[model samples]
Target: MDPAPARLAVAVKAQARALGFDACGITDASPPGSAPHFANWLAAGHHGEMAYLARNAARRVDPRKVLPGLRSVVCLAVSYPGDHDNPPPPPALRGVVARYARFTDYHDVLAARLRDLTAFLNGLGGAEARSLWYVDTGPVLERDLAQRAGLGFIGKHTNLLGRTLGNWCLLAEILTTVALAPDAPERNRCGTCARCLDACPTRAFVAPFVLDARRCISYLTIEHKGPIPLELRPALGTRIFGCDDCLAACPWNRFARAGRLMREHTRADLAAPDLIELLRLDAAAFKVRFAGTPMARAKRRGLLRNVGVALGNLGDPAALPALRQVAQDPDPLIGEHVRWAIERIEAP
Candidate 1:
C-alpha cells in the first residue's frame, strides 16, 4: 500500500469520526453481485408488495450504474444509543412507535453530514475526485458495502453489527472517484448465537441470514400499504411502528459504548410513547407531532391501521371506545383494522 492513499484513508476515517460518524471504512465500488439472491427473494414473493425493491434491479446491484465513474465506496455508521429499558405497553392503549422514530429523521442528519464530508473530500482535490452520497434513500446495498469495508459483520439477524456500536446504528455510503485503500471485510463474530432468531415474536426470520419481509413487524407496519394480515396481528403486540426484537437480542449490544453529543439526535420522545395519545392523532396532528421524525413515513392512516392491530392484540375491553371511534374513520383501511379490533375486543 502506497503511503499517500494509506495516510489519506487514515485521515479521512479520523475526520469521519470527528464529524460524528460512529464508524467508517473504504472499499472498492464493485457491484455487490448479490442480485441473483435478491432476484430469487423477490421471485419467492419474500419482499411482499414492495415493488420498488424489484424495480431498480440493475442500479441496486451495481453502484457504477448509478455513478458511472465510481471507484471506491466510503461506508459510515452513525450510532443511535438509547438508555431506557424497553417498556411494556399500557394494558388497554394502542399505537407504540419504535424508539428510533422518536427523534429527528436520520435522513436529514446523515445527509447533512455526508454533504459536509463530500465538501471536505472535494477540497482535498478537485472535480477529478468527485463523490456521491446516499443515506438509505438511494438504491444501495449499504449493509453489504459496509461489511465489505470492514465497518462490521452482518449478524445472523441480517442487521449490521459493529463490534463497539452493536446494531443500534444507521448506515450511509459515499460513492467516490478517489482511489482510497480498501479495508478487509470483517470476520463473522456471531458463532452459535440464535438469540435474535428465537426472540422474534412473529418468526419473521425464516432462517439464519434470511428474513421474510411479509412476516416482519417493521415491514408489516411501515412498508406494507394495506391492512395487515389477520394472522399476524396478534404477534404484533404493541409495536405500531417497527419491531426491534432482533436487534435488541443481539449479544454485541452489551459492548455498545455511548456516542458523544450525537447521542441526543436519536434520543427524544420515542423511548416509550403513550399508545392512547398516538391513537387519538389526526393526520394534521400526526404531522405536527412526528414533524421531522421517521414515524412520519407511515402517514396517519398507516399508523392508525397498526394501532388498531395493536389494540386487537391487547384484548382489553377498555380499548373498545377508541377502536370504535377509529372504526368510523374515513379511510377504509383504518376503518377495517379498527373493526377487526372491535371484533377481537367483543370476542370471548
Candidate 2:
C-alpha cells in the first residue's frame, strides 16, 4: 500500500472542506453496484417524464463511459441548515419552495467551487491529470457512488443520508484520471424504519426503496412541465417547487449540520413566496424574480402552474380572482392549472 495516494486523498478531502463542502470521500471509479437495479427501475417506467435519465442510462451506470481513464470519484456533500431550511408555510397564501431550491440554483453555487476543487486535484496529480465535475446533472449514479465513497448510506427514501448531514445534503462529484485510495463504504442503517415512506403525501414510494416519480410532488411540480394529473393536485398542498417530507422525516437528521457553502446562496425571498404574487408573475416578472434560482429552470409557466395547484389546495376564496385572471394565461399549461384552481375554490 503506497502512502503517497493515501496522503493525496486526505489533502483532497481537506481541500473540499475548505471549499465549503461539509463531507467528502474518495472511491474508485468502478461501475456503481446498483446499475442493474437502476436499469430495472428505469424499465419499470418509474422515472415519469424525465427522459434524460433514460437516455443517459448507460453512462449513468459507469463512470468510465463518461470519462475515459476515470480512476477515482471525489464524492462531496453540502448540508443546508436542515433545522430551519423548511419553515412552516406562512399563515398567508404563501407557497413553500423545498429547502434545497430556496437557495440560488445549487448547480451554479456548487459548480464554481467544484471547478476550483478540480483544478486543485489536477495540480496534486501532476500535469497529465484531468477531471470533470458536475453537481447533479452528470451521467453517473451519484447517490450510490456517494455511499461507496463512505460519504453516506442510501436510505429507504432512496436519498443518501449521513450521520452528520442527514438526507438534507446536496451531492457533487469529480471524476478524475488520478488514482486514489478508496474509502470504506457505508452500509444501510434504515432497519425497521419506514417514516420516509409513510411521510409522502402522494404515496410516491411504490415500495421501501422504489419511488414512482409520476406521483412525486417534487417531480410533478418541478420536472413535469405539462399539467399535473387531477388526482395528485390536492396532495401538492402549497409546495410550488419541490417536496421534502420524506427527507424531513428521516431520524438521522438528529445530527444534521449547518452548511457554509449554501448559506451564502440562500434566497430569503423564496422561503415563503406569496402564492398570488407568484401566480401573477408574467414571463418578465418571473425571470426577474427567479433569475438565479432553481425555479428559473421550471420557467414561468411551470412555476405558475404549480402556484395555481397550491392555491387550489389551500382552498382560499381570496385567491379566486387571481386564479380566474390567470385561467386564460397565454401558456395553456398555466391556464389549465389555473382553471383547476378556480374550480377547486368554487367547489362546494
Candidate 3:
C-alpha cells in the first residue's frame, strides 16, 4: 500500500490528467541539477537583452527561494500536436510562426487547470496546506524542474523533449507544502544528436547545449526591441515571430502526438500569416488581431519590425510598396527596419 503522502501524489497525478494535462510527475523541491549550468550561462552574459533572467537568477534555480515551506513540485506537461513536420511551404508572402504560438496564449490555456490542481492539493491537505502554481510566469527553471520530475530530458538544443511527448509540449508546475512521492528523474536521451544545432538559421547554438541568445532568430524577432543586426537580418528568412527549426529537427518527434488541452485554441491564421497583411496592421488592428495570442508579446512595432525583415528576406518586389509606406514610421525602430527592407527589395 502507498503511504499517505504517496497516495495523495497518485491522486494528484490522476486529477492532473483528468484536467487535460497530458503528463504529470512529482519531485521533492530541492534545487535542480541545471542550477550550476544556468549560473554559468548567465555569468557568461549569453541571455542577451533579457535582463529579467539575470534579475531573478537566484529564484529561478532554486524553487525554495520563491515559495517557502515547499515540499514537492508537481510538474505537468501538455503536448502540442506534431506541428513541425516538413509541411508544404506557405504561399509567397506568407510568413512562418513558431508552432506553439499558433494557439491562444498557452499561459492562459494552462493557468486555469494549474489553479484547479493547486486547489485540489490544498483541499486534500486541509486548511494548513499552502500551494502555488505557475504556467510560464514564474521565475523557476521550468525545463530543469520538469526533467527532475521525470517529465522529460533537456535536449542538446536546450529545450525539453520526452521519449513520448517529443519537443512539442508546454510545461506547468505546482509548488505545495504537502508532501508527494517523487518520480524517478529522467536522464539525457540525446546521446550523439546534434541535428538541432545544425538546423538553426542564426547558428545560435555555441555548442551542444549552449545557446547564444544574441544571435537567435527567436530572440531577435520577438524579445528584442531595437534594430536587429544588419549581418543577421538576411538569416531571418520568413520567420516573423519565433523560430522552430531546432525543435522540428528532433528525431524523437516521430512518436509525437497532439494533446487535447490546446487543440480547441489553435488558430489556423497563425499557421501562415500574410506578411503584407501583417505589415499594414496599425497599433489598434494589431491589438485586435493578436489580442489572445502570444504574438502580442512582440507588440505592434516589434512585430512590424519583424515583418519588414521577413519581407526583405523573401526578396519579393511585391512588398516594396508596403515597405516604403512604413519607411517613415514614427517608432524609428520600425522605420529603420522598413528602410532596410525597401533597400533590400530595390537592390540590384
The candidate that wins on TM-score is 2
lDDT order of candidates, best first? 2, 3, 1
What is candidate 2's lDDT per residue for 53-161, written digit by digit as tens?
9999999999999999999999999989774655776688998888888888899988899999999999999999989998987999999999999999999999999
Clashes of 2: 0
Candidate 1 clashing pairs?
none
lDDT accuracy of residue 284 in candidate 1? 81
Clashing pairs in 2: none
Error of 2 at 332 (Å): 1.3
Q: Which sections of candidate 3 miss by over 4 Å? A: 84-89
Judged by whole-model lDDT over C-alpha atoms, candidate 3 comes out at 0.90
Better candidate by TM-score, 1 or 2: 2
The Cα local distance difference test for each model comes to: 0.82, 0.90, 0.90
Where is the poorest 10-residue window by lDDT in model 1?
A: 82-91
Candidate 2 lDDT for residue 288: 96
Q: Write the per-residue lDDT of candidate 1 for residues 1-348, one digit (tens) a residue.
A: 567667767877888988888899999978875568777777888888888878987789888888888878899988776434436455546456665665688888888889998887766656678888999878888888888999998898888999998877888988888778899998789999999999998998878988899999999999999989888899998888998888888889998875653566754476556666777899889999888888888899888888888878878888887777777889999899889988988998
Please state the error at residue 348 of candidate 3 in Å.
0.7
Write model 3 residue lDDT over 1-348, tens digit each, in one string: 559888999999999999999999999989987888998899998899999999999899899988999999999999986654325346799888888888899999998888899999999988989988998888999899899899999999999999889999999899899989899999999888889999998999988899999999889989988999999999988888999899989999988877887888888888889888998899999999999899999999999989988898888998888888889989999999998888888889
Global fold similarity of model 2 (TM-score): 0.98
- What's the distance in Å from true for residue 218, model 1? 0.3
